[model samples]
Target: MTSAAKPEADQTVSGQLRRALHPGGWSLRGRLLGQLVALVAVACVVMGVVTEVGLRTFLLDKLNGQLAGSIQRVDSPIGGDQGQLPLGPPTSGRLRFLGGGAGTAIVVIDNGTVTDAYTINQQNYGKPVKLPPDALAAMETVQVGKRPSTVDLGGSLGAHQVIAVASDRTPGRVLIVGLSVVDINSTLLSTGLIMLGVALIAVLLTALAGELIIRYTLTPLRRVAATASRVAELPLERGEVALSVRVADRDTNPRTEVGQVGSALNRMLGHIANALAVRHASEMRVRKFVADASHELRTPLAAIRGYAELTRRSGDKVPPDIARAMDRVESESIRMTALVEDLLLLARLDAGRPLRRQPVDLTQLAVDSVSDAHVAGPDHKWRITVPDIPVIVPGDEPRLRQVLANLLANARTHTPTGTTVEVAIAQLDTGEVRISVTDDGPGIPPSLLPEVFERFARGDSSRSRAAGSTGLGLSIVAAVVTAHRGNVTVTSRPGHTEFAVHIPSED
Candidate 1:
């Protein structure tokens, strides 16, 4: 392979190995259970291997001992002849007397020539059968005076562990004795199979028990996670949040690892609850202060406007500059009064004061608000679109009318002259009423869209201060709609701006 191709192939193999080792998206419980099962399987495999090796060694040693005893018997003096080999067909009798078992092969090589070669055949009633030439040839290769070695002799003799020893009586004669190792092989095979079966059973039991124990151990952690999820779902950005969700007392025992987590979660929730209480208390104080201050400022603001108008019409010859000053004073007083009224309304809404519920006709409200906008901003074109059938929603009539008025005033004040402002009201199929105010003009800046409905939020360029905007019109609209359990949203781009309010229908 090329050098570049080698790196690619290596990378592919590495990636495959990584994926095989660490599969993605496995949960904690699954990972723990898998590790436990893998560990048990590995241990079972190791134990089986060790036991198989030990058993095979022990069996081989026993077979070797039997072979040694056969060699010792072959060398022992028999029938008053000092280790002289019996000749002819009587070799089978001599071998039986020497304790040779079935499948045992015996070979006698005298002066480099095999004289007698035979094996005990148990099927033939202990009769010795003449060994085949191939069996004798395989037996002659056995090393003399060495440890028993396994050799395969073809034609039904199979394999045998044989040892060759020099004859004591004859200098050139050699006796070869061997015992079959087929039984030992069969025993080891059976033992290996049994070990595998037992190991599999043990691994299965371990897996089952581990799964149950791991599940039981992680139950408390699951409960703690559930509590945290519930807390996250709560609306805690504003107002008095109850913050009542907490880990169960039993789960928070602080003994086990999961219990410690549960305990920490409970303590954290307690701190959050206390913080929310303090925040609600601070918010309450601010709302009360604003409501009281606005209430107190109302009377004095009314007096200032009344006195300014009264002086302007007193028929006294006033200077032109003084008349302008008086006019400015009355206009600013009116603006301040409007600001104070908006603040007071926001305070009441923040206090969660309930609104008066009644079936109010949104079509009529749209028409009246548009007519008022036309009078206020004569340079801007105003239009209203309402269904032929009236759309009525259960809400306070005054508050709903104010919502439409504020929306229309906002459109008129923000857009330039000749911009067409359209007021559209419709009853939706989902049992809700929608009031949308759209204007074809330079839309609100993109930066201000997120907080457009927040108090005193206004664009510096599109929204003009000379139009006497109190900057709380949209905020008031949002507060009143929220009090009636409705929602308001704004969308703005270059040439289009729309403010939509959705209120659920009474029916």
Candidate 2:
């Protein structure tokens, strides 16, 4: 498709989706289900983050409050000479050994001389310390350990450190305490991961529960689809699937597609049943008309035969005019016979009589038919055109020849003496064989084109003479072409007329 057509096509699809899904601007069932899942997941993530942050804040507040209380209870002065200070009570069972572990220490600075004042362990506490430039700058401005400072303790320590401060109520100096935030961070991360694992399991269960709810809610719809499939597969001619087979009513709710489909199916079945009844009645009428017409013709035929025999027995004793009247009777009888024979042929074609089919050379047949028409209508010039090779097609040869013959004869009888009839046979690009019979004649009127193939229809209905024609020739051609699963079309104008036949090559 061109770019200009793309927008139109997209608009069509958008319109269809809107019609199928929206109906009245309300959320569809599928979208509603999806929204529920998304909302639940988002709520889970938000709650998880809030809870983790809240826990971390609470731990920090309790730890800082305990540090203040411990400092207030100290009896030593802040700027006293370097010495160990009195140990405090345990903050918790988890943190009780902090004052005497390898990872714990305390230090004090007074009069420009730094001293390892309170040692948790001599080997770990005696290590020399140095503060990072940024940490030292931040420490000088804030009071409470500068909100958890990190510095380096070099010489027996590493390039990374933590420096926390505590001051006694009577102190004239600052008491600094330090511990690695690495341990605290590792513990917080492990707790967060555990919480995340629990959250994931909770989310999984929630999603599965949501899916189950959706499946349960849609049970009615699934039942309706299965019922529709079953009903659609049913053969309507058998009159199965009574009205009781209908989908259960969902009240007057038109917002639901399932409801609309159910309602539509019920209405469609009602229409089908009515149409099938009318068709059955019409078929029966047609069968009876054909049977009655056939029976009626036999009576007149028998009467004509009886009268002719009587005339034959009477011989020359009959009046001359009476003899002429007998000849007229014979002529009328022959006409009646021809009419009956044509009717029988139509009936057989209508009833789908089997024909002998084979791979017939249509090119050869066209040449023969055209030559025969030339001989028959010596006044007209007939021409035949065929492919260089035989155009072989699978069809009944006798019926196919009859099609060409009828077209040729119609042109011969209707056109002026000098008119030309042309026959062409070739294969179309779609692997179908085409045969055309064209003539240079005063063509049929446009008004008669529509029903030209109807039984007993005549293009020239206002003939003055009673010609020996039943007017079923084109109708027969249509029937034969239809039985072969093909098509026949005619194009006609003043001084130009053509009838083309298309049949499948594979056929």
Model 1 score (lDDT): 0.83
What is the TM-score of each predicted model, taking all chains together?
0.82, 0.48
Predicted candidate 2, C-alpha RMSD: 11.1
- Model 1, poorest ten-residue lDDT window? 1-10
Candidate 1 colliding pairs: none
Please estimate how well model 2 matches the true structure, expressed as its whole-model Cα lDDT.
0.65
Q: How high is the lDDT of residue 148 in model 2?
A: 48
lDDT of 1 at 335: 91
lDDT of 1 by residue, 175-217 (tens): 8987887888888789888988888888888889988999988
Model 2, 341-436: lDDT tens digits are 556656666556776679988998998999899998999988888889889988888888888888898889778899999998988999999999
For each candidate, the alpha-carbon lDDT, in order, equals 0.83, 0.65
Model 1 regions lying over 4 Å from their true place: 1-24, 74-97, 103-145, 149-170, 173-178, 378-381, 461-467
